[model samples]
Target: MSPHDLGRIYRSEIEEQPAALERLLEHDAEIASIAAALQSRGPRLIRMVGHGSSDNAASYGVYAFGLLPHWTAMRDSITLTVHYDSPLDLSNSVAIGLSQSGRTPDVVEYLVRARRSGAFTIAITNDPASDLASAAEATIPLEAGSEQAVAATKTYTNTLAALVLLAAHLAGEGARIADGVRRAAEQMAESIPAFARDAEALALPFSYTGRMFVIGRGVEFATAREIALKLLETCRVAAEPLTATDLAHGPVAALDPLFPVWAIASPDATLPAVQEAAQRIRETGATVVASGTAAGAVQGVQYTLPVPAPDEPLLSPLLSVVPGQLFAGALARVRGLDPDAPHGLSKVTLAL
Candidate 1:
């Protein structure tokens, strides 16, 4: 197969991200109305909930929204709906549920409860016909299209983009976000090929590194987790992700001379702490690779992803996770694992 064909499955998915954003923007008026209603109500709290890649998006959303003054954002559907059965303050709350397919039972159930409890609910999903979307007060469609590969690629990026857009909307910065989205889409279009090339080259070495660790701070921490999940699901490799501070607590002991570590070191307030953690991990004699926009922050092989503009810093997770997805997909191919069908996983989880 030709190189173009070999990577076409992932490349196409990556390239379509911009178009997906365009679709979202084209529907901006409807989305903006929803945002206005939600913001006008002035929710006391904001909750983002999902599973798998969607969960990762929720995690990122929490970080992005928390940066706003007096905003209470969290990822707690599982804990609240399943474990504690706690009654949330829905009278002044907005519940955002994310799902690529909008079919997850837990997500659907939680959103239903949230809505019935009087909270404004929004569904971020690719499938407009899905149950989750039907239950939501408003649906922000993720135009990622149908992803053939079980491991999500475009959907993950689109979800993060949607969440960030939602954040900007809620914060009453719709016009600014629209501008950023356009710029980000253009930058992403230019960057996908470079990302593919860089990730392909890195995958050759990654295949041999049986075990790996991903570390990041702040929103990048969620990026690390998403990367770890992608690697584990698609590459069928044992990968772990930890927060920079959490790594120092106990996980650091697992680091050794033979391990390989990947750090998502974006330019943020936590960059210093992440840089220190990367340095400490390097001291363990592990080969390290750092990916970020900043120059020379990392000591080893560094892949600097192009950033469109200095984003809300809280929204960096949307851009940071793209490289990780590419790396995971490429590494899976390098390891002779089927990117479409890893060991034993389905495209959709239907546990009714």
Candidate 2:
């Protein structure tokens, strides 16, 4: 409706993210020291545990660090920490638990178990004194302030930033990743207006769509998943995300000529594969909206986002996810659903 209303939502999120990011940056020295300590110990394994957006960050962290040689990054649900009674090699293991509030019972219990098992525990949370943080051997605070909305905005982005920074440090690319993240933040800030406009327009089509598909590859595969979650959680719509390659094997058959397929194709090593997958999806008669670089012929709309300079594809998710966020929020409004409340979900999921 009014520009002021839209601006309030968009700018609130944008403003809070940088503040949270600044807090993380302020503690970089401590994070680096802890990461170095863990590295020197040659942890037998590194595991990430969380739920919701925190779980998504876990996925991204695993992908980010798995690329490094000699490092094993695995995603472990909090259930695994609570239910598994088997002997784990926790003596030299590191558990990175993600929680915005740090008070989720499952997350807190899991971290406590991991700590008891002698694993090097690090809690990434907005709350410095949360139960999860208290249970952790080390805590990295996310500066994302009180997120008023049930659907997380600034916290998710800040978590990703902090996780990527941790991953880079663990992978021995701290300085490089920091530089990339800083650049990505600036790029995200610069591109927000354009992305907001695009998202507002894209929302018009998906407002009534019963279902939507988000597709991507590599790091963007997680990006697609996050977008799907945002749409479903914030927009009260049925949205699914699948790897571009995985879609052809089974999911593609379900698509019709009117199906909306949102493709995320930023410039990564996986771009070629993503582009090829987008092409194949289009052939299946699904309406395709390509949202990345390397534009090709698609049956439907094409929203080409600005390619970040110097080509740090790992950092693209920071900028790419903004449009999806806006799209989800606006689509919710179009559907007469409040983006802030969406269905029956709350900001903090306390139960296991």
Candidate 3:
């Protein structure tokens, strides 16, 4: 099937991300102020909590904090913090909660617990007035508007953009973020058709491939997880996301020609490690394809998908995740499934 023939609301949302990201970057001033306030308090640690797509976005935050500020940051489990009442001394920390709808019950509870424990709580969501926003000390609106499709596209990318803005501010690299955001947006706009064409071609031949492993390191690790989730929800593929380091230790043995491996290579310090991992996977005879922006990021791969390799590598997620979203939507359509609505998923997942 051609890209045009597989039109769906999910595809529309995937195309909508460039504009939504432009809007998200407009809130730089607000993010700057929040960063200033947080810096003044000198947070020594960051604890982020979310579910599903939100969790994937928050994983980028964890990586950002470590890379940019060299601080200790973690993505905490909401179930343990909420249901089991896990104890944490968050006095010198900032707790962040992310949810697209801003109403995930356990995520809200995570923020509440953090706040009660004297941590600074921040909420990131598309809804400024959501319960998650209300539960935190401050909020960062996703500015992605209403994502009508059950599969998140704009919201997920916008969430990453918002987090990058916040990370830039905290790292005192605020001046560079706007330029990076603009370039990423432009590149994303230019690359959309290329991604669509690649998606159509790949899906036509490989849509029925039952399972795959996605691997990346550092910032791109979140991209790996997000893409795997998209494949699972949309194409009904059993996609497992793994770290490049961990996979080499053991999981690499399970990979071969029949089991596909998607390696995300970003133009950053971690590129060498990821490239090595992808090269190793390729030798295993698995159908290994790569998605990245840098000229040599995907070197030696049999198939490649291009995205903006942004000057600010932290913001690459805004561009990298787009091609993955398109692939998932196109694969769903080619496989005789609806990309907009999956079989057992909904827009907002409410769990106690």
Q: In order, what lDDT does every prediction score?
A: 0.77, 0.75, 0.84
Q: Which of candidates 1 and 3 is the stronger one according to lDDT?
A: 3
In terms of lDDT, the best-performing candidate is 3
Tens digits of per-residue lDDT, candidate 3, 1-352, equal: 4445454778888888889988988888999999998998898888888888889998898877777767788888777778888787889999999999999888898899999998999999999999999999899999998898888888898888877788878989777887788788888888899888987788776766989998888888899999999999988999999988878898989887789888888777888888788878888988887886652566677778877677777788888887788888888887888877789888887868
Query: Whole-model lDDT for model 2 versus the true structure?
Result: 0.75
- In candidate 2, what are the lDDT values of residues 1-352, reduced to their tens digit? 5423533553467545655666567777777887788887788778888888888777677777777434778887566558766556587789888899998888888888888888899999989899989999888888888887777778888888887787778778888887777767777677767876877787786667888899888777767888899888877668899988888888888888767788887655777777777777777777777775433432244545443442466776776677777778777776766676666887787666
Tens digit of per-residue lDDT, candidate 1, span 120-150: 9999999989999999989999888878777
Off by over 4 Å in 2: 1-11, 68-70, 293-311
Candidate 3 similarity to native, TM-score: 0.95
- The worst-scoring run of ten residues by lDDT in candidate 2 lies at 292-301
TM-score of each: 0.92, 0.92, 0.95
| Clash totals for all candidate models | 0, 0, 3
Clashing residue pairs in candidate 1 are: none
Give the per-residue Cα lDDT of candidate 3 at 98.
91
lDDT of 1 at 255: 88
